[model samples]
Target: MTSVPDERFPLPEGFGPGSVWADRTGHRTLVGRTQRGVEIPIGHGEGEVNPGELLKLALIGCAGMSSDVNLSRRLGDDFAMRLWAHGTSDEADNRYLSIAEEVQLPLEGLTEKEIATVVKVFGRAVAAGCTVERSVVPGIEVTHRVLGAETDAPEEQA
Candidate 1:
């Protein structure tokens, strides 16, 4: 497992900003080391999944998990959750065309007002807590570096 970048979660308490370990092949499992150095396994489905899609899935999954825990704790009942997100972008300039997420949260037992409140709260929390979602906000500084097999940092610096 490779650690996600700082742009993701602020490196949980025990995990470092970017610390992860993963099995080389078969049964994909990526263990992230929190800042506190606790090894937490990241769950994944058993199938041929694209690494690119997994990046987006991470954010969605985290938000879904967070909402589930929070709502369950507050309401004291397990609620059904359905989350779907899709985004389009231009490959050349990496410009986003559109990004949309639909969260279907069932509050069958709760009152209407309570349902509204839950949606608002959950939306805010996911907006702030979801790393991929957060990254879409403008003005975030990011740098990309390319390193070649024969590149020498010291020489390049000169």
Candidate 2:
């Protein structure tokens, strides 16, 4: 249960992000820890999920969170819903090309107009509010550095 970054990917501090601690648990598997103490399993079918799947989850998770308020206002304060994200990997590019999100919302008793309004509101809310989606849409830059490995501070500075 270890994804020991071989000589191939050398960073010593896990992937490029400063937010996750991807400690190898086994071959191709790592447990990503966040500052909040949440642990996310990561791997290529090794852990709970892979990186690409995580990205899709991020997108849909953001979408649902963003639409929460709007949905509650119209669909009742206790509306129920489930979200899903799907994408296929592009082996040549080593990334997912496009991801699609689906939501199973309980629009049971609402009229056609109400359902339409709810859908529109949810769509607009997600488009304007999901920061994760926004960031992924244009792509963001990720710069990383190996901390504590830079250089020893002088005794006085330390």
Candidate 3:
């Protein structure tokens, strides 16, 4: 992947709440950890969530959680639902061009009108409350600076 600096991107003030970091544990592998002791396996290996999957989940997962209140008001509190997110990658840019989500739920016993209302409510709730979705829609600045680099290292510094 290649990167180009965009000065228009905002420079964030400080780290957000909580501590999150990753450690190299193997070849092309990393173990991401949270301040609360949650460990997420991140790598290209055939295991758990990698970086790309994590990004997609952040989008769909936020939608599901935010829409839960509206969906539960229409469907029962215990209604079953499944959400999946996929991204269309732009190979030339090495980034996702777009993302689409498919939500499956038990809509049996409800009228056609009621079903439509439920779907509309779900969408509206997500649009209003899903932070990740809102951020991606308008785009957000993501800046990276490699830590532990020496001034006299092999590569040039920014």
Q: Estimate each model's TM-score.
A: 0.50, 0.72, 0.74
Cα lDDT tens digits for candidate 1, 32-131:
4444445544555544444435554655676676566666765567666666656645588675454445555555666657765665566656655656
In model 3, which residue pairs have backbone atoms overlapping below 3 Å? none
Over the stretch 61-107, how does candidate 3's per-residue lDDT look in tens digits? Answer: 88789889888987889988777776656789888766667677787
In order, candidate lDDTs are: 0.50, 0.66, 0.66
Measured by C-alpha RMSD in angstroms, how accurate is candidate 2?
A: 16.3
Task: Report model 3's TM-score to 2 decimal places.
Answer: 0.74
Residues 31-103 of candidate 2 have per-residue lDDT tens digits of 8876556788888773488888788888878878998998899878898878777678779987666665667
Looking at model 2, residue 57 earns an lDDT score of 82
RMSD of each: 16.1, 16.3, 16.5
Q: Could you tell me how far off, in angstroms, the CA of residue 53 lies in candidate 3 after the best superposition?
A: 0.7
Clashes of each: 13, 6, 0
Instruction: Give the residue spans of candidate 2 off by over 4 A.
Output: 1-18, 45-47, 139-158
TM-score ranking of the models? 3, 2, 1
> Number of the top candidate by TM-score?
3
